[model samples]
Target: MRTLTLVRRVAPLILLLVVLAVLTVRAAEQLDNQDTYFHLRFGHELLGEWSLRDPGSVSSFATADWVPTQWLPQITMAAVEDRAGLAGVAWLSGLAFLALALTLYVVARRRVEPLAAAPLTALALVASSSGLSARPQVLSYLLVAVTATAWLAAARSGRTPWWLVPLTWVWACCHGMWPVGLAIGGVAVLATALRPDRRWDRVARGAAVVALSGLATLVTPVGPRLLGAVVAVDERREFFSEWGRPDPGDPRLLALLALLLVAAAALAWRGTDGPRGPRTLRGLRESPDLTALGLLVLAGGCTVASGRTVPVAAALLVPVAATALHRHLGDRPAWTRLEQVVVLGGVALALPVLAAVVPHTADEPPARPAWTDPALAALPAGTPVLNDWNLGGWLMWRHPQLDPVMHGYGDTFTVEELRRNTDILALRPGWRTLVRETGVSYALVRPRSPLGRALVDDEGWRVLHRSPDLVLLKPPPGWM
Candidate 1:
C-alpha cells in the first residue's frame, strides 16, 4: 500500500521534471541572442587592444564615451567563445539555466512541498523562456534570486546583511540592470519594517541595507555615472520595442497572469483555522507591510510597460507564489529512506532519455544575412558604409575593417543620431543627401529594406553586388 502511494506521488514529479529539462534545453537551442556579436566586439577589445576602462573605437561614429553595461559577462562569453566555439556558447547557456533551475527549486522548496514546488518552478521557467539567453541579464536573474533569498534569511533574524554591499558591487560590474537588485532589496526591507510587531531596530537595519545597496552600485570603473548607461536609450524608447509595453499576445505575459491569479487565490485566506489577512499582500500571514506586493507592482509594472522585463517578473513572482502556497501545500506522502533513494535514482536514470528527446540547434541572433561576406570582400578597408541596425555587430566581429553605422547598444548613440540612421533606412525626405552628409558612401542591407528598394530605383546609387537577402550598393563617385 505504501509502495503504491509512493508511485502515485513520484509519477507527476517525474513528468514535471522531464518537461522542465526539455523546455530549458530547447530554449537554449532556439533563441539566438541578437546582441551577442555586439558584446563580442567589446570582448575582443578586452582580449587585446583595450582594457575594461578603455573601450576602443570600433563602432561607427564611436564618439559618445561608451560604457560596457554587461562588461563582466561579455568578457566571460568572449573567453568561452575563444575556447569552445558557438556550440560551447549554447552549452554554457544551458549550464546557466541549470544553475537557475537549482536556485529556483531551493528557494521555492522553502515555502512549499516538493510536489507543489516542482511545477511552480517549472512554470517560472516557462514564463522566462521567451527572454532566456547567454546575455549578461542571465547573470542578473541568478543574482536577483540569490539576493531575495539572502534578504529573506536576514529579515528572519532582524539583522542587516553587510554581505549585500559587496554583492551589489559585483552585480553592478556584471550588468546594467544592477539597479534592479537595490530596488528589490529596498522593497524587501521596507516590507519587513512595516510588520505590525516589528521593532524600530529592524526598520533601521532595513533602511541601512537599502542605502548601502544603492552605494554598492557605484563601485564600478565608471563610478556612479555607470547607471546613466541604463537610461541612455530613454531618448528614443521607440527604437527598442523591448523597453516598450508588453504585447498582449506574448506567451510569457499570459503565463505570468495565470500564475499571479492562482497565487493570489491560494494565498487569499488560509491557516490551521480559516480566514487570513489582506489578499493584496500576496497572502503572507500576520503581515501588512505589503512589501512583497509593492515589489510585484514595480516588477509587474515594468513588465507591462516594457515587455523586456517579463523575466524579472518571472524571477520575483515565483518566489512570492511559493510563499503564498506555503500554508496550503499539504505534506508529502510517507516514504522510507530507501523509498526516497529509489525515487531519486529512478529520476536520475530518466535524465538521459529526457535529454535525447529534446531537439538542439545553434540558432544565433542578428541572424547571418546571406550576402554579407561576399559584399564585405568586394569593399575596401575603411569604407564609410551605412549598415543594418542588427548587421553592424556581425560585420564588426567578422571584418572590423568595415566601419559600422550602429548595433545593439542603444545607449551609445544620441537620439538625433539614431533618428538620422532610421530616416535613411526609411528613405524619408533628404535621405539621399543625408547619406552624403554622414559620409556614408556604401549601404549593406537586406534587399527588402526600404532603402534597398530605393537604391534599386535611384540612378545615383548603383547596386554593386546582390545576395538573396542582402545587397551592397554604392553612391555615385561625385555624390560624396
Candidate 2:
C-alpha cells in the first residue's frame, strides 16, 4: 500500500521531468532563424528608448510610423542577452515552451483527468511546434492557451474572468495577438447569452469583461496606434509563406484535422442513457453546449484562415476536444493534491538544472564569415549594399554601420518596396533597372543565386569576396 501511494506521487513528476528535458535540449540548439537576430536587436533598441517610434537607427528602411506591438518580449530578450548573452536568450525560449505545455495541461485538467489531458496537450504542442520559436509569437501562443482556458472556465461557472481585462493589456505589450484574447471572450459571452437557460446577469457581466479587454489593448504604451500595427503586415502578407493558406501536405495540419474529427465524433455520439431509438421531433430533448460549440466555430475559422492561425486553432481546440473524449470515455477522478504537488514541484526544481546546462549547451548565434569581415569593414559607414533577404538580419545586428536594402520585418516596408525586393531577388523583369535605381554599389548574396551570377557574369561586377555560402561583389565603376 505504501509502495502504491509512492508510485502514484512519483509517476507524474517523472513524466514532467522527461518532458522538460526534451524541450530544454531542443531549445538549446542554435538560433538558426534570421528573425531571432532582428528581434534581439530590436529588443536592445527598445530597451534604450523604451518607445514605439521609428527605430531608424537600427534599420535603414523601416517606416518612421512603425509600431512595436511586441515590445515587451523584445525588451525581455534584450535584457537577458545583455546579462547572459545568447545562452540566456536560448534559456528564455525554453522557459516559454515549458510554460505553454503547463498551461495546456492545467486548462485541460479542469474538465478531464490527467490521463486524457496530458496526451491531448502533448498532441496540441506537437501541432504547434512549427509556430514555436525564439520569437514573440511564442509568448502570444502561451497567452492564447491561457485565454481560451479562462473563457471555458467562465462558461462553466457563469462567472466572468474579469481579470482578463488587465491581462489583455499585458498581452498587448507582449504581442499583436491581444485581439485574439478579446475575441475568445466575446465568443464565450455570445454563447452564454444564446443558451436556452441563460442568466442575463452572467451574460451582461461576461460582455463587460470582453468589452473592457478590448479597451485595454488601446491603453498600451503604443496608444491607439497599436490598432493599426496589427494590420500593418496585411499589405506584405503575400511576401511571407506563413500567411498563406494551409498546405494539405503539412503533418501539423493533419494532426489538427484528426483532433477535430475526434471531437466531432465524441459530440455527435448518443449514449444508451438517451431515450431509445428514433422518435418524433418533440421527443428530442438533448441540448448541445453552446459555449463549446461557439468555441469550436472560432477554432474552425482559424484553421481555414491561414497557416499562421492553424496553431492557434489547435491551441483553442485542445481543451474542448479533451473534454469531449473524457466524457465519451466516462468520468475519472481529477489529479490528487499529491500528484499536483509532485508535478509542479518537479517542474520548479528542473528550472535551475536547465539554466545551469544552457550556457554550455546553447549554441551561440551565427557569426559572419571571418574572411569577408575585413572587406565588409572597409566599406564606408552608411554604404548601401544589396543583400540576400536572410542575411539582412546579420547586417542589421553586426554591421549596423552599413545599410542593408531589406530584412524579414515585413510590416516595416511598403507594398511597393516589398514588391521591388521580390522582383530584384528573383531576378524578375526590370530587376536590373531597380538595382541601378537603388544606387547600391555592392551585393552580398548566395554564391550561386541569380543576382550573384548576374553581377559577376552579366554585369561584369568584381568579386571582392567569395565563399561557398555567400559572395560579395562590387559593380563595375559608374554602373550605379
In terms of lDDT, the best-performing candidate is 2
* Model 1 C-alpha lDDT versus the unseen true structure: 0.68
Task: Compose the digit string of candidate 2's lDDT tens values, residues 1-480.
Answer: 999867655654566567666776778777777888888878888878746755544555544357788888989998999999888888888888888878877877777666566666777777788888888888777788788878877876777799998989999999887788888888988889898888999999999998888888888888888888787767678998888998889888777887677667665554544367654332123466566677778888888888888888878888777656655555546678876775687567557776887788764766567777788888999889999988887678777678888888876777888888889989999998999988887889987888888888888989888888888888888887
Candidate 2 root-mean-square deviation in Å: 3.6
The top-ranked prediction according to TM-score is: 2
| lDDT tens readout by residue for model 1, 112-132 | 656676676777777777667
Summing lDDT over every window of 10 consecutive residues in candidate 1, give the lowest-scoring window. Answer: 280-289
RMSD of each: 4.4, 3.6
Question: In angstroms, how far off is 304's CA in candidate 1?
Answer: 1.1
As a TM-score, model 1 comes out at 0.86
TM-score of 2: 0.91
Superposed by TM-score, candidate 1 places the C-alpha of residue 318 at a distance from the truth, in angstroms, of 1.1
lDDT of 2: 0.78
Report lDDT per candidate.
Answer: 0.68, 0.78
